[model samples]
Target: MTPTALTPPLMTPAQRKLGMVLCLVTIVLAVLDMNIVSAATVPIVRDLDPVHGVDRLPWLVSAFALAATALLPLYGKLCDLYGAKRVLLGAVGTFLLGSGLCGAAQSMDQLIAFRALQGIGGGGLMSVTMVVVAHLKDPEDRGAGRGGAMGGIVAGLGMAIGPLVGALFTDHLSWRWIFYVNLPLGLLVLVGAALVLKLPATAGRRSLDFLGAALAAAFATTLLLVTEWGGKDYAWTSPEILGLAAVAVVTLVLFLWRQATAAEPVLPLSLFRIRVVRLGFAVQGLVGMGMTGSIMYVMLYLQIARDVAPTTASLYLIPMAAGMTAIGLLVGRLTSRGHSPRTFLVAGAACATLALVLLGLSGPTTGLWAVCAELALLGCGLGQLIGQLITLVQEAAPAHQLGVATTGIRFFQTLGSALGAALFGTLLARVFEAGEPGEPLGAVRSLAGAAREHALGSFTDAVDVVFLSAGGVLGLVLLLAVRLRATEAAAGVGEEDRPVLAA
Candidate 1:
């Protein structure tokens, strides 16, 4: 039973406006959760491990990335098969529940599990928002409504003040407050999306491609597992690493093959055949790897390396946020004039790569202003590309399949983000250990006024090494940018799937 046209329009104007507001709030809550935890890492480790063994610590970040990436496409398909309004409301509910669990966590393992639970919701928050926005308007208006909405979402007041917000939660309130903070906001979004977001009914009996979902999840888990444990939990040459890597390769290949043939496939293979979707996803993957991976490290360097207080460290990040907002608005304006998105993609990737390379070479004594400038450049590059790609992906896709297609773009990028963090974090720890004075952990623990400052000198060098490596990755993203064309983006969806609603 294919869906009938239950509503004259796919969604109401009022619903669209309210949904956008709710979506923006979700992005803020989600992004804040990602960074706020970083500030709590050292303190949580100290409280749990007076002996200072941090073997299980990486799970805090890794779990969230893994769950979010794995669930992204899952939730996206749900939105397409069921309805965005239903899925969005469910996601917010789950996010609230997970947040409560995180606040109550008593052990490291419990916290990791709870965080992963939160990520399941976070995945829906991101993927559904894009689809819902696309459903609100015609393809021509996407840049103004969807792209502008995304820019505003990122440039929103909460994200603009995120570092400061996180610092406040970490400094005065308990670190648990960071997780608890989402409760009120999540509830608000839940209500808004449920009541105001009405979409065309999806009347068909949905058949999820379970085999494809399982294989994709298996592949993602295996890849992340090897990256997470390869250097830390076990030696890279160990059986565990080799076995996991092999399993990941086999499973991913199997997933691809299954997608090729499955009826009602989880990931429509035809999407990759569309030049815009392929190129857009490729650039987004590389950029996401570099940007998200480097986010926490940059903050760590500012607070630990430069010896700034949490408040001051958060304050310094304002410049980057400002740069992103400013550039994002400018690019948003450009999109209205029918400007080619390719130039922006290539230039943004190039600028980001340049900034990463420069920052990677900076030393402990490097001027604060200089570091800030490079960060601003990086932000500028990211702002120019982020909203543009998201909007383009949505535009290229047909209305009925928008959710699944958009989620694919986000999925690849998020997988890259996980790999980046795990790899870079392991490298940072190893380098810091090698360079530390005798009883390095103890020495770091004992330092007083400038204790974090002295410790950061070692961290600065390590971060530089990571940044340089990330720059190389961004080069590939730049190449993909050249392959993007407006015509390709316009043809991202198939002729058959172009309906405004499932009906």
Candidate 2:
């Protein structure tokens, strides 16, 4: 079926506004939870002091990320089977329930399990919100295009504010309040969605591809494990890491085969045949890696090398947040005017690469303002790319495949995040090991003289290497963006028509 036929009718202006608000609020909640815990980690570890050492602390974040990433495709399929509104409401409710449980947890194990539950809900919040926003638009109406950009802004804001919010809660009330804070905001979204969201109900029954879902989940989980553990917990060539890598490869191959053969695939293979859709996912993955990896390491550099407090380190992201928010809004407005998204994509990639290059050249003696300027440039570049890419994919997809197409992009981006963290972390670890020999960086911190200076210098060099590598990846993204047909504008397809791929 064509995309227009599958798209629901547009809502009235008031309803549309309310629906967009709900989508943005829910998305912020989901995105906020991902980063907010960063500042709270110390407090949580202190309070819950489980038997496992501090090494297990990473799981608090990883569990939520893994669950969210693994369940994205399934949530998309559910949105198609049920309605977006139903799936979204259920997701929000589940997230709130998990939040409550997390707030009350007295042990690390319970918190990890509850976070995973929250992540399952969080996954649906992101993918389904996009689906809902896509439906808010009439196929021919460019006016509704702002919804995509708004979503992008909300996501950026959530990421920007998470650490500051976490620090506030941890310092003033308790670490648990960070989770509790979601209750009121989430309830507001739930109420608004219930009152304002009006879409056609699911009229016919369709069989879900359970086997495809299971294989896809297994593949994603194993792949994440390989990335997370390869060089950190085990040697890259060690039996455990190698076995996980092998399993990931096998499961991914099987998942692809199943997609081609399944009656209703979790991720339809045909979607990749569309050039824009294919390239959009690729760009999203690369962007995810570069963007997230840079942000993470930058935070580390501030805290570790510069001795900035966690809350203050988060404040440095203000420039990035501003750049992204401003550029995203502009791109969204331009999209409504039928601009060539490829232009923005190419420009964004170029800017991002330049920003990374600047970051790589920065050092211990570099001025703080200069670094912040580069970060702003990085944010602007990413802001231009992200919202535009979402618009391109949604515009290119066939109506019936909208949810799948949206979720497919997110799935790759999430995978990119995992891969980026692992790859960058491994690179830093190897560099640190080579330079420091027997001493850990933590141990070096306790030294008072030349040992401390040498270790910090080594850490700085390692960070520079990561920045340079990330720059190289962004350079590749630039090439991919340039290859996309610049003539392909963000225009509407007819009810009976499918988007034409450029030759």
Candidate 3:
């Protein structure tokens, strides 16, 4: 069936506005939950005091990411099978339930379990929100102008505000308030969605790809475990890491084989045949790795090497956020006016690469203003790249497969984050250990002045290495962006469907 035939009618102005508002709200909450919790970790650890010690603290974050990443593909398929509204509402409700439970948890284990539940809902929120927004716009309105601007603003704002909001909750109220805060906002989103969202009815019953889902989940979980544990909890060459790697390889092969043969594959392999779609995923993955790794390492550099407070270090990111917000909105507007996305994509990649190179060359003697300016450039590149990529994928995908295609881009990005964390962490640890063997920086603070200087220098050197490596990755992204086709399409729904109107 043609995608246009499957699309419901365009939404009325009121319905479209309300629906977009609901999508934005849910996305902000989901993004906030990911970062806000980072600031509250110390308080959480003090209160729960897991018997295994603070070493297991990373699991609090990893558990959520693992569940969210593994379930994203499944959620996309479910949205297509049922309806976007139904699936989205379910996801919101589930996330709210998880948030409440997390706030009330009495043990570290319980908190981790609740986080995994939250991730299940969070995954759907991000994937379905984009699907909802795409459906809201008429094909004629899908150009880079307003559509691009809205998406860019949404992405930039949600990410930029997360850490700041988390810090606010942690400093002014109980750390638990971070989770509890979601309740009121999430309830509002749920009620609003129920009243305003209207999409096409399900076509018919289709068999679930249960086997494919299982294989895919297994593969994702194994890979996440390898990334999270290798070289930290266990040696890279240790039996545990090697065994998990083997399982990941085997499950991936099985998952691909099942997709090719399944009556209803969880992720349709045919989507990869589209040239733009294929390139989009690749560029998205690389950008994800570079962006995530750079953000993390920069924070560490500010806090450890530059002797800045955590809160102060976070404030320094303002310039980057500003650059991202401004450029993202501008590109969206420009693209809507019929400009080629490839232009923004290539330019953005170049900016991102240049920012990383600047950062790598910076030292303790470098001015703070200079660092902030470099970060702003990085933000501009990311803002343009991310916003345009979403538009391109949606434009390229068939309406029937819109949900899956959108979620697929997110899936690759999430995978890239996992890989980036693992890669950067390993590199930093090796460099630090080689320079200051058996002496952690925190432990050496009480030592003589000379020893302290040595520890600080080692950390600075490690940060430089990480930044240089990340810059190289962004350089590759620039090459990929240049190869992208400079085509434009106006995405819209057909007349067979009717727009939902306010009562």
Model 1 lDDT per residue over 1-503, tens place: 22233232646566667666777787777777766776677666676554632777778877887887787777777877888778888888888999999888877778889989998888787677766666655335544534533553385344556656666787798778888999999989887777777777665749888888888888988888887787767988899899999999999899989989988677788777666777778777787788755566777777666667766776666667767777777766676666655667777888888888888888878899998898888877776767567766665555556677878888887777767877777777777877665535335535766656656666677778878878877777777776576446555456654434322
Q: What is the C-alpha lDDT of each candidate?
A: 0.73, 0.81, 0.81
Steric clash count of candidate 2: 1
Model 3 spans with C-alpha error above 4 angstroms: 1-7, 50-53, 145-148, 433-448, 486-503
Q: What's the lDDT of the predicted structure labeled candidate 2?
A: 0.81
What global local distance difference test value does model 3 have?
A: 0.81
Write one digit per residue (lDDT tens) for candidate 3, span 393-498. 7767666677788888888988887889899898988888899999865664456688877888888888888988999998998987776654222322322222
Candidate 1 residue runs with Cα over 4 Å from true position = 1-12, 42-55, 138-140, 148-160, 203-205, 292-315, 336-340, 360-365, 422-465, 486-503
Candidate 3, residue 250: the lDDT equals 100
lDDT of 2 by residue, 1-503 (tens): 52234334556767776777778788888778887888888889888884563777878877888888888898888877777888889999999999999999989989999999998898888888888887766555542356556765775687678878888999999999999999999999998888888876664557999988988889889889888888778889999989998899898999999999999998998887777788889988998898866898898888777778867888888888888888878877786787666777788889889998899888878899998999999988887767667767877776667778888888988888888988898888788778988877666557668888888888888888899899998999899887665424443334443532211
Candidate 3 C-alpha error for residue 398, in Å: 1.9
